[model samples]
Target: MKPLLSIWIMLLCGIAGRSFAQTKTSTDTVVKPPVQLKTVHIVQYNFFKDSLAFREEYAKSLTFRRLKWYEVYGGLSVNINNLYRVTQFKKNKKKITFKHMLLNKEQEMFVSRVYTPSLVNKVTHLDGDSLQLFMQHYQPDYAFIKNASDYDLYLAIKKEYEAFMKTRDSIPVQP
Candidate 1:
């Protein structure tokens, strides 16, 4: 029984010694190359000034490992946090809101107006208040231009010309 126990202990020691020797040779013979880090630029645009800016320290060189989903999510979160830093916000210690951060009065007004393609087309056509004053002086020229042979168009032009002349006549003449 004593000899058998002694043999078991000798086998365990031999296995442990072989493992240590293998680890040492593997570590010594295999040289790990120095890590090559790449630099990344973090850019942010200032909407009010219409300019872009970047930080030297924040855009430092980095070493990237495998691209994991969680790491990608974390990177996006960091980018959002950096973006928020550039914007102006009104906040107390208890609460914060981002409504006023990247917006000005003019931009807010523009955003408030829901501009559709039809509205843009109408604006391009010179309709509404803009054309009201012009229309008072001259009937829309397009009606006469497109249908030059029509007697009604000719009458309309004649009427507009007379009205414009009458308004001119009404103005007091400077001698």
Candidate 2:
């Protein structure tokens, strides 16, 4: 019985040693390359042209996007400032400026579309410096253009052209 017990203990020790040796040899034989980390580039939305929906989406992504220390500081400062009335006024001013810029651009586009050089030329039969002079002098305001129909605009241009022709010689031609 003592011999049998000794044999069982030796067998268990041998099995454990073999398993440990096998694991060690397996780990030693396998070669792993050093991990190479790739640089990640994050792109933020354009502030000028971004729509409200896009702004909302971008704000939602703030949690995942990694920002620099200064960027984080600046953002927090701006957000905190937004809670106060004085800082809010500054934001409102910026918005007003942006709105005015957009309105001005729209007005310019409307003027270009309705009071085109071609339309003026066709109406006046004038060319070169005189045509340019007439258009500049009689350039309709945004409000007038907005309120006037196509026919009204055409008649107005024709009438203005006639008036311009009468005083054509009187107006000084810029060199």
Candidate 3:
């Protein structure tokens, strides 16, 4: 029984050590993703409800496809202040910060809401067009592109915007 218990303890510690070791980013070898990941940020005034609704729908829309999607929900222009600092979305954690400006005092108050997803799946239900639109448009005015053989992220953005605007009848697909 003592030998069996010792083996179990050793196995648990081995798992724990491996988990901690995996968090390090490897600089020597770089793994590039085949398809580019995209996100869009749109701003609006006097349409707080609409913006919130769109945020929720955006999340659902993103989940439509078999890829990871991200949506930000907030009131009016408030979310912009905090979400901007997020350089990258950490795996399963959703961090939300709320701030309110007080008219009487010269200080801003801060409140944060942190949620860990019960179950996180990087896949969802959006169509190809919508998915394309979501990734391409960083702002309503900004689009990002994935480079081809000459793959330039910026050029991809430019091409996608032009392609999105032109009519299919204007130019037919060339075989």
Candidate 4:
């Protein structure tokens, strides 16, 4: 390559590197909520969030090696389409495996009303059972998501808007 071109390339590389390093250090980072709720307080909170986003567009192809959130639980932000055809759930603890056709989708759960003072110690809640539950419930779904995408696998997250309507009469809400 010409010397002038090479010099210009070096200058551009240096500028790009410096700008990237500075931007990364200065960017604002958003923090997520600490996980672990024995019973979802406002059961509708997460259910509502996902219900709003369930239907953007399903990608026809998937590149994941495992299932995602949509496979086990339905939520608004998850894509649902082709996944219903081949989704499977393997419960390692119980030594039970479930396929889409085998899962008993007819689940009946009442929202457990928790009565706790807001100022109670946070320390008691952080322990083994909560961690296990967290792993049992959330880790696998994320594991699935980490491996898969819209390209091949397809599944729909339960839309939030309708979820409330479907369960509104069933679970009494606190005003």
For TM-score, the strongest prediction is: 2
**Over 4 Å off, model 2:** 1-81, 85-91, 172-175
Our tally of clashes for model 3 stands at 12
Over 1-175, each residue of candidate 2 has an lDDT whose tens digit, in order, gives 9999999999999999999887785447767798999989998743344444444554433223223334424543654432353435565566566656655765676677678788888877888888889987888999999899888998999889888889988988765
lDDT of 1 by residue, 47-75 (tens): 33331221222222211122333432454
- In terms of lDDT, model 4 sits at 0.37
TM-score of every candidate: 0.19, 0.47, 0.15, 0.18
- At residue 26, give the lDDT of candidate 1: 46
Model 1 ranges off by over 4 Å: 1-10, 22-27, 44-175
Report clashes for each candidate as comma-separated counts: 0, 0, 12, 20
lDDT of 4 by residue, 67-144 (tens): 554564456554555365345444321223222212222111101111111211131232444333322222223334
The runs of at least 3 residues in candidate 4 whose Cα sits more than 4 Å from the true structure, single-residue gaps closed, are 33-175
What is the overall TM-score of model 2 with all chains considered together? 0.47
- When sorted by TM-score, best at the front, the candidate numbers are 2, 1, 4, 3
lDDT of 3 by residue, 1-175 (tens): 9999999999999999999788666765688779966977886533446445544755543333222223333544445534444434442233221111121111111000110011001121224554444333422221121112223433544454455456434533432
The candidate, 1 or 3, that scores higher on TM-score is 1
Error of 1 at 71 (Å): 52
In candidate 1, how many Å is residue 151 off? 73
On the 0 to 100 scale, the lDDT of residue 78 in model 4 is 44
**Model 2: residue 111 alpha-carbon error in angstroms:** 1.0
lDDT for 118 (candidate 3): 14
